[model samples]
Target: MIAVLIILVSCCCFIFSTWYTMYKNRNLPPGPTPLPLIGNLLNIERGALVNSLMTLWKQFGPVYTLYFGSKPVIVICGYEAFKEALVDQNDAFGARGETPALDPFAKSRRIIFTNGERWKLMRTFTFKTLKDFGFGKKSFEGKIQEETRCVMEELRRSQGQPMNPARCFSYAFVNVLCSVIFGERFEYSDKRFSKLIGIVDDIFHTMCSIWGQEKNDPSSPFTSENLLYVLHSLFMGASDTVSTTLRHALLIFLKYPDAEDKVREEIDRVIGRDRLPRMDDRLNMPYTQAVMHEVQRFSDIAPLNGPHMVTKDVQFRGYFIPKGTNIYPLLCTVHRDPTQFATPYKFNPNHFLDEKGQFKRNDAWMPFSAGKRMCPGEYMARMEFFIALTTILQNFTLSSEKEFTEDEVAPKLAGFLNFPIQYELSFIPR
Candidate 1:
């Protein structure tokens, strides 16, 4: 009787382990083999999630899965997979992945990182508020114009000397958001605003630190974490990405002086030498618009839109994705997929221009992402980049301060965001 009881328990344990293993591996997308308990966590870098995933896509097919400590993460690569997941089944993938660290910080409020009804409410409110402020309005153009004037003044004060445009551009960009959300502009030297920016900067720096960990110890304000996450996403999304793209734009122009001359010719013919290019003239400037699109495509910032989680069990293409599976949309794979973009690796403005020489929209061009969880600040970002780039280009001829080549200005991966290594440039007044 004792031997029979022991045998029965041993059999039951073996069966349970086998069932669990099968359940975890069954009907999932193809990916790197995960260990029995560790999953793919060991394969991934501590902080460089995007780079690691992109490398995986090169090995695995476009659509693959990864595991984060037994948690399944679906990585959608190439344009087709990204479109299908983000657009076709938008509602199914609307939920954001909950992280132990982010939960305490977010409290699940704010538009950038919330889900469900809260996401809907925050998005709608933000959209309406932005529309009321200046999006799609005549006054909106005026606000951008005002900000451009300030940027131009600062550039002019540089006296055609080499200077870091990052600070000036960031201040102007943040002020644009401030004008709409906070309803005021901050002085460049304001202590409080400066501190806020510093805090935001720290959050970004911390996010990229692999050794950093979030502590939920007592005596910490909830608002501090909340503000940190919000400002981190904002600064990371807005400042580093756009500034890097603009830096690349300058490098591209210098490398191809003919294109630069053509852009200047277009601006000269459309707006003339005395006045700066205005938002209203965007329609008439096909080359400039094409250049902007190419810059976005070539830079391919934010290759993956962070991680998203499955809220319910889902089955697709003969695969069963259980509840709580995480999904990562690989925007870089989509943007650079040979199947989608012609000569995907080449920097070509014609990709965004039609035979008629007018601006054309490409469905495959999804720098801001797509679907229910697409970038809420898409319109605002476009406006900022357009106003900032065209405004600066219209007034100045940009080139490297030293004899820096395009290869020298190429971006080195900095966490998820790719930025041009520290390089200086001269913005000689046109």
Candidate 2:
């Protein structure tokens, strides 16, 4: 009898809390019913987070809300609506939101998570520093060129054997980024480098973004904690993304040898085999530029962009969004939007090239996101992708060791980043 009474009381409390939570945010955008604690998490299909979100767009229209626990998360779909929230109406929607899954991981102190004046200060400092550190400049390209040679040398050691290129790519990109962050690069065999990587993984699961520093700046927010998280993000940002894109680019080239041949031809024609590819060479080689853009487009990394929140309570297209509502601009939908690309589902390089064979601009091709809150590392990452890819094609022709069906390379999206499944290839010397 006592046990039954306890169960009944617990049920009543759960009911009341769920009701009170729903009543408070009644004006927020609508979507599926959220459970008492888990919210719409269970509703998301397993291993298909990106696809499931896209499917929900069909039912919910351009914008709607889902829940993470009791917190309301607004999902924005399509190019125009996604751009409006991220690009145009950025003041209200630009702030980063802390979800239960990501909040515990991101310390709410780093540039990727913090908001308002804090974000502004860190962003300004970081961007200025990155620019000063040679981002988008020829000097940065020189570093990438040096790393490209190192990776090519590693590939040459493979001697035409079927090799999984992920490690080689990771080693090269990580060192390049580490040099940018720490003023030097580490050899693959360095024990200290391995330990530093372990630190990055440890920080990822914990939100303790602090390491107390005795000195202070009233106007500055660069705490040791902030610096650590920044370092963590640099390593995290550097570790997988650029490497994955390069991997995907190689995979696509393997799948489409004709396209690979075109890139090699462009490299040979514009820069010659004797010289390394330069960022300036991109202007003269439209097809190579098209290939690079298409790889990003096709890879569709970060399908749901980093979670953003409203900085303040605002009126948005017939909805009243309370301050602190989590927002996800569906980038996968943007990349695959029929309106944005001619053959959105197919791997076509012409999406970035005009009939005159010039590299045409597309505002919708936003892999790094946009607006005041746009990724500070955008230019650096793009430059790395361009220089690394072109140089690789310049030195080697990638061929699949084992034939794969179209569906084989189509790996399911995991977390935020998406790319082809791991496969082996021969880096045949050109």
Candidate 3:
């Protein structure tokens, strides 16, 4: 009789445990069935997270929930849902989710991850500092012109020889940021600056590894396990992503020479062949603006911007999302959403141009994201990319070694940021 009682009690405990889990998750958003304790561990395939999340969006609608070791992750794929959470409820969704790896690095300092009062203070300071350095003014235009001259001199030194433009582009981009932040610039030959740039690249590649996946020998200089992570993030976040986009832009231009010709023609007509294009010319040069927008859209960098954390418990469409819930903003999904774009797959600049050929603003074209935490250096980055791209095209013509096609330039997912496989091209002087 005692043995029978023990077995019955054990069965009751098991039933209760199962019921408790169901009760806890009863009001959570819909998702694939999660196993007890392990949650959805078995459902997640390795190294295909972005693809898997996209598939989940199709199955679970715009908003869905997934569990990672008992932690709830809220995935927002649809633009409307994302807008509702990130924009409408901006204050609630402003906090970045905790990553064990990034925690040590961004313990407090950097603007990207730090939240609350710290984030507000840093963000405000960064914007003011950027403006002081000519981010949206004529002073900034002079700096870009100077940088363009430096690039022209460097390219001229190539003497029409086949040389990779990555290094030069990286230097110009980084220098622009350095001038704005550190109040200085570095020569291309400066070894310390080169090392700093290398460290930045390393951090970017390391962060690209999926969360929880560890690399780097803890002792290595490139290892971004601590304070270095913040530095690495700032540099890599600003430099590599922009540089890779520019590289892809050049490659795409060579592949689509007709588009290239049109852009150059527009530049010539607006700014003329005598002087390099300026930031002011961005408005007057509609074709060039369209091409710039198209490059950003087609590149699709930072598919998933790490993860966001809810600062306070909130209700969304009758679902209660507790504070500290991880939120994944599917940027790629929004950029390619058919509901928002006409031809989500094609590389047409017409997406940004209206019937009259004027640059048209699309709410969906959010490469740098929207709301409070949008990229702080967006204005500076945009001006740099435009000035560098148009100036290069204005001075020279680009072509590949062989009949390289756009389809051939497949994007290799570099962690979160997508980059094209290395390819060669020639910059012929026009």
Candidate 4:
């Protein structure tokens, strides 16, 4: 009789606590009611995180709240909502929010995870260093051109036999970044380099994102640990985006051979078989540009994007989001916005092509994200993708033994990043 009374009292306390918590946060945007501890966990489907968030967007509209445990995360979706929060109201939403899965590991030391003053200093110093190293400029093309030559030779050795190009793509892309960071590039045969890449791969299979320095102050952000973490962030970011995009691009190319043929045709017409493609050449190659934009749009690489925090209390679309509230500016919604893309789900290059077949920009094509927290490597990544892909088409025809179905060609739309299914293809020399 005493044990039963204790259990009954515990249940009553739990009920009261939950009710009080819900009532306190009643002003937050409406969505599915959350449980006491594991708030909204049941609402999310297993192994389909991006899709689940998107479904919530449809149900609750663009701006709504979901609970992760007791903490409320304000999810901002669609192009208009994103623009308002990230661009227009940039300062309020500029701060980095807690990524609980990554918080322990990151410790807010790296540029990618920190907020306020430390973030500004890290970002400023890192961008200046990256610029000095020729990140987004024309001078950086030399490194890419040299890497492209090496990649082509590696492909030639494949002898038209089917092979997974993921490793080769990784080596080439990472080497360019390594050149910037370490002032050197590792050989493809370097065992230590390969092992290090493997470790980074394991971490990505596990969570993912980066930099800098003041002087000898105790409060300075320039410690050896900080520097190491910054390099770690750069390596992870550098290796992932271009390589993953290339993998998806190749898969899409195989799925649409006509698109591949057009890319090759344009390459031959403009760049010719004798020379490598240049950034200047991108201007005249409208179809190739359209294809690259479409690839990024359809691939939707970083779907959830990084979590952001509100620096101050703000009103958004008739919702009251408190200061320090975590925000999810869903990139998947922006890229897949039906109002923005003519065929949001399909791999249609025409979304970026005008009536005259010239390349046109879509405001919603935000694969790198937007505003103050926008990717620092946007310009470099754009150049890399353009040059690397144009170079590939300039030399080889992408061919696969197994034909990809429409579903296979579509983005997986799951997890932190969307990766294409593992498949082999031949780099049949043009």
Instruction: Output the number of the TM-score-best candidate.
Output: 4
Please write out the lDDT profile of model 1 over residues 1-430, one tens digit for every residue.
9999999999888666754774354778889887545678777887666667778988988778786655677888888878877788776776887555445445423556677775675566556545666666776666667777888888888887788777777667766666655678777678887776676556654554211223353422223454444434665555555666777777777667777888788887888867756667889999889888987887777676656777788775567777777788878887788886787777788888899989888888888888887776677677777777777778888876466565654445665566665666788987
Predicted candidate 4 versus true structure: per-residue lDDT over 360-409, tens digit per residue: 99889899899999998888888889888988888888887798899988
TM-score per candidate:
0.84, 0.90, 0.86, 0.95
Q: Is candidate 1 or candidate 2 better by TM-score?
A: 2
By lDDT rank, best first, the candidates go: 4, 2, 3, 1
Identify the superior model by lDDT, candidate 3 or candidate 4: 4
Better-scoring candidate (lDDT), 2 or 3: 2
Query: Per-residue CA lDDT of candidate 3, range 318-403, in tens?
Result: 88888888888788788778797788766789988999989988777878886666887687678788888888888988876667
Model 3, position 163: C-alpha lDDT score: 75
- Which number leads on lDDT? 4
Model 2: per-residue Cα lDDT over 85-164, one tens digit each: 88889888888876566666656336787778987877876776677676767777888888888888889999989999
Local lDDT at 7 for model 2: 100
Clashing pairs in 1: none
Residue 300 in candidate 2, Cα distance off native in Å: 1.1
